[model samples]
Target: MTPTRRGPKKIDYVGAQSDGTKLAADLPAAVQVPDDAVAWTAVLGESTVRNLHSPDWKTREHALQAVMRSLGNARWNAERSPEDVWNTVTQLLDKALKDKVAPLYYASLELLSTLVATYSPNLPYGVLTQGLEPLMPTLLHRVGNNNARIQETSIQALLTLANQPALGLAFLAPHALSAIPKKSQSGAAAAIQMSGRLELITCMLNVQVQQQMGFGTAGRTPAAAAAAGKGGDALMAEDVVRFTRPALDMPDDKVRTAAVRLVAEVYRTRKAAGQPFEVEKMVGAGLKPALMQRLA
Candidate 1:
């Protein structure tokens, strides 16, 4: 028999270069920073910023990211003027607002957050009042996104906006207020109360009472109010009293415990502010025996 023709031995291809450089090779090119980037003269030249909004997604993203990074760097360096960055940022934000793409929407929020953190001095109050106002409704609608990063970023952006009193009030207007309680129930009640979302404050207080009484999550009542800071303390005491009274009456040990915590926080807040303590009276009227025994 002809020397048996053997199939070629399959060589196991382990070699010094086994690690794949192919992925690196296949990666997209790094975005080019135009020579004029970050130059105030070039940035403000007529039609400079407008060109940044061209249909190229990568370009828009690069421009926004570069502007944010430069703003941060300038803030750190203290060498660059803020006015230039502010103008460019506002122009980029305008472009982002006009774009219908989801990525651009999300990027606009990121840019806004950076603007808030870095260039508040240069950013006009009117810009925050008008330009940023419309974005909140859009963001509130996206809070349920399966992307946790997006959800968290949106909440953080809202929180950042709320740090300013005027913007905070604008944010609490009906539409944004409606989104807080829809979050996962685990933190929903606490977040609503802490956010000073008065519309849902009573409901959250009741939940906190339930939790404190061992009916639900424990120790969340005062914790929620404390998280709200002074803004929450300003919520009418009558509302707090109204919500906690039923829990004060419940025979359930956990409910009683929770109610006591809620009432105490209200009274504490009022006392701290040198205001009348009305929550106790409401509790007494609604659950006389329980208040006398538990809260007294």
Candidate 2:
């Protein structure tokens, strides 16, 4: 008699019910699609939105992929009211960003990066701030994600958002400052998060300085661009004085180094812009002491 055959043991994955549900094929890469060919409505229909909330990971994953691929399509400009569409999709994105599955989480972040890169310039100020500002904390915290690639991707997303003219350095400064702790903690993980936040603040300031100096103004009229740059410069100067002093006292070497680099960059940017930065007056007595302590 043949030996009794054993069936494979059954194992259940939590939250992955209907895992075999068939979904539409993945959309083509965004670059493959002709610029003027597709509209936002066709790409993000009712079915795709429904799939994003599906219990099956693959369905949600595919839905996000479709949105990301079709995000750059040409018809966003023709929509009657983009605020309505932005609000709908951003709410979906908030949920998707918290997805437990790795692929889905990364896909959500990638979509966010694309969303900011593509729409920041075109969306109305109220709409852009309302839609994207709330996501800043999530992106900042994700910098400490265990996956290295995810960390890098999150930083790239933040940088992309920062570089946009619609949202200036001031918008991200509050989130970055709030993410770092007031009191230093005694763990490696805390240090890493602190370092990431500090580095992010530095990058944001660098982007702002570039903007204020007329480096990346592609579409705005010269007068409008100069006005926007001045607003950003004033806000950024305040933030530098607010945070750099405490950042220098952080326990991590990397965090301290980032703080020092941020200060140096501020001086360099102010000099290049032909703006006088009276460091003693702007940063006050506190920062000088902190810098002196760090040097010692």
Candidate 3:
């Protein structure tokens, strides 16, 4: 009789020492960091926040980087809760977001995304609701800014929130997308109501539609989960954000046209979702003329 072949057995992955002994983690029964270490970490966190508000862009950028690093460190984070750190830095974060300087905005966005990505497990679960959800409106508003750094970082920050199953699928998903159009403004002889618009439509794709493997588990609705399964191909409408105005003042027709396409896609999706849209009401709205001229 022919002998049946068997596949090799799988073994548990273990690091081996030079002596061929399996290595084990050298963890103490409990972390016993000294009082001075904790106090110093708190000081470092405070100093970093101070640097973020410095007048010099270099100083601001360096501070943001420092905050990002300190938040990501395991021992440092253990010393100070993420919520405490975030509360202390909230004002600085707000300033960074509002700063017209591209680098400051980019660093702020990166800092938020980096924290969720790096410290999700080590930090408390409340950061999602307490630390992140409160910042959603500001993040959504910035998504419409024409500046590349602001736009991309906004998208990245949103995606990071979407990845958290602990916060539930609705933490940062389609259910949360909504905004009112900025009222039209007049000329130099008249008061301007609202002049700012957008040239930005980065992506509605939520790459962070990932699985929940943490403490406070949160999952998406069936529809949201189904849409997420399609990944990048998910219709941009799957995650809609109301646009207050168009971003088409750019001289380059190619750029304007691209912006128009983004707006058209967004408008179509927004309508399908039954959300309010006033871009068509604005005469200078970039999406309007682009669509009309093409039809004519």
Best by lDDT: 2
Q: Who is ahead in TM-score, 1 or 2?
A: 2
The per-model lDDT (C-alpha) reads 0.47, 0.61, 0.47
Candidate 2 C-alpha error for residue 235, in Å: 5.0
lDDT of 3 by residue, 1-296 (tens): 99998632211111221111111123233322223223334536545544544445667678778877877687877787666666545534554565555566677788877766664544544444566644655666555444455556666676566655443344454423343223222232111111111222233322322232223333343443443453322323423323322325544455455545655656654565577546544324344564556422
* Structural similarity to truth (TM-score) of each candidate: 0.41, 0.69, 0.50
Clashing pairs in 1: 213-254, 213-255, 213-258, 214-254
| TM-score, candidate number 1 | 0.41
Full-model lDDT, candidate 3: 0.47
* Per-residue alpha-carbon lDDT of candidate 1 for residues 192-237, written as tens digits (9 for 90 to 100): 2222222233343343334334563222234323333423322356
Model 1 root mean square deviation, Cα atoms: 15.8
How do the residues 158-261 of candidate 2 rate in per-residue lDDT, one tens digit apiece? 77765666665545555666635433245676666666666666766766666666787422333333433443342355566466766677776777788777
Tell me which of candidates 1 and 3 scores higher on TM-score: 3
Runs in model 1 deviating more than 4 A are 1-51, 73-91, 94-106, 121-124, 164-175, 178-296
Steric clash pairs (candidate 3): 165-218, 198-247, 199-247
Q: For each candidate, how many residue pairs have backbone atoms clashing (under 3 Å)?
A: 4, 0, 3
